[model samples]
Target chain A: MSEAARKGMKPKKNRAGLWGIYLALALIYIWAFSGMNLPEIKPTAGQITKSIFNGMFHPDWDYVSDPGGEDLLHGLLDTLAIAALGTFISAVLCVPFAFWAAANMSKGKAASGTGKFVLSFIRTFPELVMAIMFIKAVGPGSFAGVLALGLHSIGMLGKLFSEEVENMDLGPTEALMATGANRFQILWFAVIPQVITGFLSYTLYRFEINVRSAAVLGVIGAGGIGTPLIFALTSRDWNRVGIILLGIIVMVTVIDLISGYLRRKIV
Target chain B: MMNQPIKTSIPKPPSKIKNYVTLLLVLFLLWGSSIQTDSSLAELVAGFPNMMDLLNQMVPPNWGYFDNITDAMLETIRMAVIGTTFGAILAIPIALFSASNLIQNIWVFYPIRFILNLIRTVPDLLLASIFVAIFGLGSLPGILALMVFSIGLIAKLTYESIEAIDPGPLEAMEAVGANKIQLIVFGVIPQVAAHFISYVLYTFEINVRAAAVLGLVGAGGIGLFYNKTLGFLEYDKTSSIIIYTLVAVLAIDYISTKLREKLL
Candidate 1:
């Protein structure tokens, strides 16, 4: 039976198709490998690597607090604040976009399709780039980080919100319509009630992500732990870098756990 | 959507207190955050013209700048390809170990899963910056960072898929006195290979985007051009770099997404 199946015309064609894919993959890999220009080895590479590892093991605990507001604690606070405001801004801005992108809400596929396209276009721009743009506007600070994250979160949040809208129980909308409720009434009483929880849950999820992004926004002088982090790295302050990384890890982990629990309760 | 009992003369509405409290709390939180972050609407309004001026200068992207960036962009894609390849290779054993269904040992999977979660917590850019700090900058650091990120992402997705694979073939193989390695080869690999490939492609899509920005921390890519242009006040060139990155990211995303769709 195996020999007959293996020798079948369909099997033969399948094998040929698989080989073609393999051949193409091999060529692509070769091209990629050829383009690689590995950097020359720095003489101190091993020593630096060992020092970084050692720093991680013995992180400077003193950096955890300071009278000055520029310590790790304050940087984390600024990061959280930026993330919170950013999430709030996106949560508000995305509501209309969500309705626009929802296929069921729009009369025609073209309308919804364009909205989807616009959201994806927005999503393609990384938040870091947006931060730079905003820095040009606000002259660099936590404000720029907030604006950037707020703007960038819309892409993801809008898409998620639109899906929530599309997947909602239409029975409620239909029933509301039968009751002669206007669009606003239907939206407020029927659509809003169903989607509000999903929207809040998604915003929380985005907040967790924004925190991570915000942690690095400071690298560009947009203001966060990242600013100090870059400063430490440049000055070869490995222990400071260690503390910041640890703080980020802890903060992100805590945010994820809290948001996950809340989302579970919400959904 | 509202339903009422026909037998009841009148039904009292549920309390709106929770709704009011939640709204109030949200408003208070927003207020506090805005203050903490020094985010003022007035400042944003005042700065709007500056933003417009910057945007005005960015018009007419320097078409000539594309030639300079072509190599850097190609290098970014190469880094992503090699990184994802390495990650996928390394992820196989990690994914296999972490999949509780396959390993069947708390001691084996839990610590690995914990490490996986910790790795996932760090953003790719942060990883790149950290590597750059240690290695003192280069494309190698970017590649290493991407490899670490892909390991986290690919392993998590692969193990999840592995756990969800059809158990029938696994049980049959076991029933036939197949050893662990034989059971995996005859049963597990066949079912998971497609999903694993799909996940790897998905990771590649993300890696391209991350790799493009790695140079921000001096790890490598077209991102360094961003610094150069902005530092030089070459707004037109900066815009071109952004456009280049956008096109590259979109193209890779499109290809990998299509491939993943076909695979899965």
Candidate 2:
């Protein structure tokens, strides 16, 4: 029992090691916050209460029914269109690229690495940055926004697809290959069926994201509801800001719920 | 099994209902999208000249601007490192609570999950913009945004890993009458720490890319230079920024990928 007691309760000989880790983590945080000029965020209880109430009740619904509100609605519609198109485009492009990028399928280091690099290069640039670049090239408009969203979405979706492929059950793929099916046939019969659900799930998820991205494309003149939203904010039109926020929240929440349902069904 | 399949009826061509339905949907999607987007082949074709013009301007990147981008690039990487470190630290408690294995209570887990889900739905750009608006513009907002973004990402990843962890150690800890804190420290943390580190590094890589673009909204870092170059229509400078950012991202990615490979 004395030997067992000692065995159950190991002596803590290196408490300093744990403490050193904590100290290092602390130093990192302090260093990170070193140049942070944290402003006094004094949103008085009263201001918060007002904002909540204003957001809830005074949503400026009248603007939605106004003639000018038509413009906002159009912008919203445009954002949705862009996001949908972007997701669709990415779905079309990414599925094959993802397969090629998957290590299992390519079996060639060059193909997978090249595919991965292409995808990472796409992911490295935010949509806004992409839009700015494309806008400079193509001139400003929804076209630029669509292209940016599509390209970036390709990068993201391709990467996710590759990960899914990498993690997929190898048994089915091997079985298909053993049947002497060609690459395309094997992929179609084996790989695609297995990963289609995941593909759809990721695509829907990206659609949810593209909705938000499309909204902000306006900030960079990519042409969406964000243009007006930014304009409203700049003009200090809290009433309009309130409307935009409400609209955005509703759009986002609805999309989220739908996408969540779709994702659950797919997964 | 053979007898059951022998009774199969002759298969027809694609079901008219399904085929037509799909065809109609495709047509509708194309028509609706084209009209809604005001997109046309004519527009795409017309835009080529301008694209070429822009590309021509972008070529032969301004070698002189390379030096300025170095500092900006360094700042961006630093912002990502700081943000990711802070976020990774803060994620631990939230991830713990959200994990099904640790917190058997649905009440605590669900609420935290809902919050994380909501936070994740808010894209990094939107978060940065909101923070910039609230805090005024600079790297501070960028860093804060990255922190929040990293937290959302890492916590979600960690909890998923937590849910999938081996339960034997957890039961063993419980059998030993260890308290919740001790059980987690010894049982849960050991199993998940590597994965947690992997996620943090993954988030750091994302944050670097994210931070590079944060400056577009005046949140700070290389994105400011991006905005300026593009604003002045200095495509060469813009190209230089793009190239530099690409190199930095590629380097970070290569290192992180190598490290992550070893980690797991």
User: For all the predictions, what are the DockQ values?
Assistant: 0.69, 0.33
Clashes of 2: 0
- Chain A TM-scores of each predicted structure, in the order given, are 0.95, 0.83
Q: Judging by lDDT against the true structure, name the best candidate.
A: 1
Specify the CAPRI tier of model 2.
acceptable
lDDT of 2 by residue, A142-219 (tens): 777877888889998999999999988878778878888797887778777888888888988999989988987888
lDDT of 2 by residue, B83-150 (tens): 89889999999999999888999999999998887677566776677666656667878888999989
Computed on alpha carbons, the lDDT of every model, listed in order, comes to 0.90, 0.81
Q: DockQ (C-alpha) of model 2?
A: 0.33
Candidate 2 ranges beyond 4 A from true positions: A1-58, A64-73, A94-115, A159-202, A263-267, B1-16
Off by over 4 Å in 1: A1-13, B1-12
Lowest lDDT sum, 10 consecutive residues, model 2 chain A, at A40-49
lDDT of 1 at A90: 94
Mind giving the per-residue lDDT tens digits that candidate 1 earns over A100-127?
A: 9999998799999999998998898878
